[model samples]
Target: MKTYDAIVIGAGPGGYPCAIRLAQLKQKTLCIEKESPGGVCLNWGCIPSKALIGAAHLYHKAKDADSMGIRVGSVEVDPEKLQDWKEGIVKRLTGGVRGLLKGNGADLMMGSARITGPRQVEVTQADGTVETIEATKGIVIATGSNTIELPSFKFDGKQIIGAKEAVSLREIPKRLLVIGGGIIGLELGMVYQSFGSELTVVEALPDLLTGIDPECTKIVERRLLKRGATIHKNAKASGYERLADGSISVKIDQDGKQITANVDVVLVAIGMRPNSRELGLEQVGVKVDQRGFVPADKFCRTNVPSIYAVGDVSGVPMLAHKATKEGEIAAEVIAGHKAEKDWVAIPSAVFTDPEIATVGLSEAEAKEKGIEILVGKFPFSALGKAMAMNETEGFVKIIADKTTKQVLGVHMVGPEVSAMISEAALALEMAAFLEDVSLTVHPHPTLGEAFMEAAAHAMGSAIHILNR
Candidate 1:
């Protein structure tokens, strides 16, 4: 048996960072991972998808460059080459994570770790060998979630697949059926759609992207429609049939009607369930809820104070950055430092064409909370930068308090808004007032100026566009 100050299970965005921080704080730490160090985000979820999205965008732009005076004959996707490039990015990032772990003096062990007691865990190696490990101070659980597979459509790892397989697909399907309209489904669907797949989105909810601002959702829906994608809301994928011609005939139910659509592949991105089962959580007295989420306090501590949980296994808003933040918090708390999960807002960015990024509250959310608010918007169509890039599909919207002039929220959907959302998150995090942003001079001919103008518009004193 080997003992350490801290033992982190699952070297994902959450676990690895926790181990590194523990080591940095001068505590002996060990991180165990069954797969890649950077977890789903680096391996198959966020990073790989973004690499493909970037390539597709570049290809699409080149193919449509006639209006920009750069005429290209034709554009095509080399799936094998693209996958190689994406894998290269993932490899570099995961390698960096490994370097960070080693540089920080954290031990990296490749195995499956399970809590055998409050301070003890058993690691099972690939060679069917089990090793006992003990943590004197804390044990951090960072195992992430897994894709929800429907009973009717089991993943064949080919024709029927989940988001994991969908991202690595080489052969571009002529027709693709995506069974969810949320972030995962829309993102991967758009990637294939750009690669020339006829897309049909079936969403069980009445609307797509349920929690986001409806106006922003509408803009994305318009873009999807323009891309020749079919959307069916309030619909359910009952089952599918494999035709003799090797195509899939998917049967969907929408409002008491049976609709059948034939496609080459089906991507099920409905949602993810927490990977809280097994690993002896219940045996160690950790409270996992009915839905499988191991609840944690603001400090990321589970019911058992000695055992902490982070990432998707911890709670909702299952973002990699969120998990990373919580991971750091848990590490610090375990190391006898003053750290807690404190933040005004955790921003969310959807990597769709033109993109949608948001932080803090929305207008509808504020109004529903019974707070009077002011809404200000500036369109990318009027921005010099947007016009120069030939991508003017969305706008910047700011929601502020009608009384105090405090900026309540910022929402944007346009080119590179994903990179600009951090500023909004900072503004909200610091509780900046509308004038604090409006009065601050933003660099000219940049997408960031929209934020300043949107703030000014909320104050009814915008410069580029009329104040509303």
Candidate 2:
């Protein structure tokens, strides 16, 4: 039997960070993982998909460089070579994650871990070896989530696939039928679309990219339409049939009308379900919600005092950064340090054709809550940097209290908004006012200027553009 101060399960973004922080706090810790160190976000979802998206963007740009007077003879995407490049990046990142865990003084073990008692865990190794480890301090669960697969459209890992398979495609399908219009679907769908797959997106919701600012969503929708992609909203994927010619006939029911779309591949990216079941959670008496999410307190503690849960298994807003933050908080609590999940806002980014990034509340959310809010808007088309880059298709919107001018939310869609939203997050976290941002000097000829300009526009003292 092996004993430690704490044992962290699932060495994903959340688990590894928790173990590292625990070790740094001078607590002997062990981190166990059944698969890769970086988990799904690094090995499959975020890193690999971003690599493909970058490749697709470059490929599309090279193919259409005639407008910029940079003509090319023939620009094509070699899928095999592209996959190799993506794999290399994944290999490096995963290796780095493992190195970080080891360097932080956390013992890394590759095995399947199960909680058998409040202070004991069972580890099953790959070579049919089982060992019992005792955690003297606490145990943290950060197992993350698994992709949701529809019962009617199970994955064959060939024609029918999930987001994991979608990112690792060696051959671009002639026509792609995406079942959901959420973040995962659109992000990966647009990647394939840019790679010359005729895209047909069928979202069950009334619109695409739900829960985001509708204005930002509309801009992305327009771009999707302009690029010759088909969209079907308020549509339900009833079923599908395999054709004789290596094609799939998808039946979508939209407003009681059955529309059939024939495509070479069907991607099911509805959403991810928390990987909460069958971990002996029931035997350990941890309260998992009906939706398979293990409920945890602000301190990341479960029903048991010695047990904690974090990351996707914890709750909604299951982002990688959010998971890492929770992991640190849990680690601190175990070390007798004062820590809690107290953050003003968490930002979300969508890697569509024109990226959408936002922090804090949306305008609709503020209005629905009956808060009197003032909005400031600045278009990328009006930005000098956007014009210089020739990528002006979205805007920056700042939401604030009409009376106090305290910043409430910031929403942006356009070039590199993912990197720009961090400033908004900092402003919100620091409780900065609209004037605090507007009065600050932003460097000229950069996308960041749009944030300052937007704040000024909200204050009704704009220099470049007219105030709304």
TM-score of each predicted structure versus truth: 0.99, 0.99
Q: How many residue pairs clash in model 2?
A: 0
Kindly list the per-residue Cα lDDT of model 2 for residues 1-468, writing each as its tens digit: 889999999888889999999999999999989989988998898899999999988888798788778889798899999999999999999998889888988999999989998888899999989999999999999999989999999999989999989989999999999999999999999998998999999999998999999999999999899999999999988899999998999999999899999999999999999987767888988888899999999999999889999999999898999999999999999999999999999999999989999999898888998989989999999999998877899999999998899999999999999999999999999999999999999999999999999999998987889976
Model 2, 345: alpha-carbon shift in Å?
Answer: 0.4
189: Cα error in model 1, Å:
0.2
Candidate 1, 129-163: lDDT as tens digits: 99999999999999999999999999999999998
**TM-score attained by model 1:** 0.99
lDDT, candidate 2, at 279:
75
Off by over 4 Å in 1: none
